[model samples]
Target: MELIESYNSISESDLLIIEEKIGYQLPVEYKLFLLQHNGGRPVLDGVRYENEHFDFVGHFYAIRGEMYHDDLLRQIEEYKDMIPKGYLPIGESPGGDVFCISLKEPTEGALFHWDHEQANYDGEPWEYNMTKLSPSLTVFLEELCVGE
Candidate 1:
């Protein structure tokens, strides 16, 4: 993906701290991505899940920043309850839906599209609201496209 207007650079320590705070190890590919581009808007922002399912990315949250809306750790804290366990909110869709990465086994490193409107407020079985987007962040980045 072609990203632009990325935030400040980050180091391994910054990622380590985030991992410690979140209590989950980030996918290696995603960590590499943060080091290269802490946060940014993708030029080819469109993503297609199937023949008719499509969405556009707004922006990726920065690892460290003064911008409240773009702060990764802050966003996680603010939405911790809403987000299902074992998933981390990594970015947002243009319409406010969340793009998350699985942190638990079997699905770790996989990316998912969380539909806010259909989210389950009740609990754990909330996996229904998440649609698998890619097997890994690496594949997800490679699949970004220009929307029509």
Candidate 2:
């Protein structure tokens, strides 16, 4: 995946380090993937960063995206089954108090989640589900700096 930069701030070497940790070469094409698919939030310059880490309705990220394996989807399912009803099934980071997300049903989409009454931003709409997802997300994220 090609990386979108916030100003020429991040170097190839820095991305390489991230790649080394993730063990998958980020295809050059994926930079657009991060921008279009991930997020569009700007930093100091007009540049923006889209992390695969935390993207919940609230909270700032200590780390972005998760490093996980293929099995995590199943794990999320198992975790979902454990949800106590009424409350959302959320994943917590071992690092600190972070934004948590809900366990989505298979029919939902991977949008940035927000409660119905909460404020909305001018971005992609989110849903309250992720159950019908492909498995690579877990592995793709597991190599990144995510925690939960």
Tens digit per residue, CA lDDT, model 2, 44-97: 111111533433212112113344311222323433333322222222223221
Q: C-alpha displacement of 9 in model 1, angstroms?
A: 0.3
Q: lDDT winner among the candidates?
A: 1
Kindly give the stretch of ten consecutive residues in candidate 2 with the minimal lDDT sum.
40-49
Q: Each model's TM-score?
A: 0.92, 0.24
Flag regions of model 2 displaced more than 4 Å: 1-8, 32-148
User: Which portions of model 1 miss their true places by more than 4 Å?
Assistant: 122-125
How well does candidate 2 match the true structure, expressed as C-alpha RMSD? 14.1
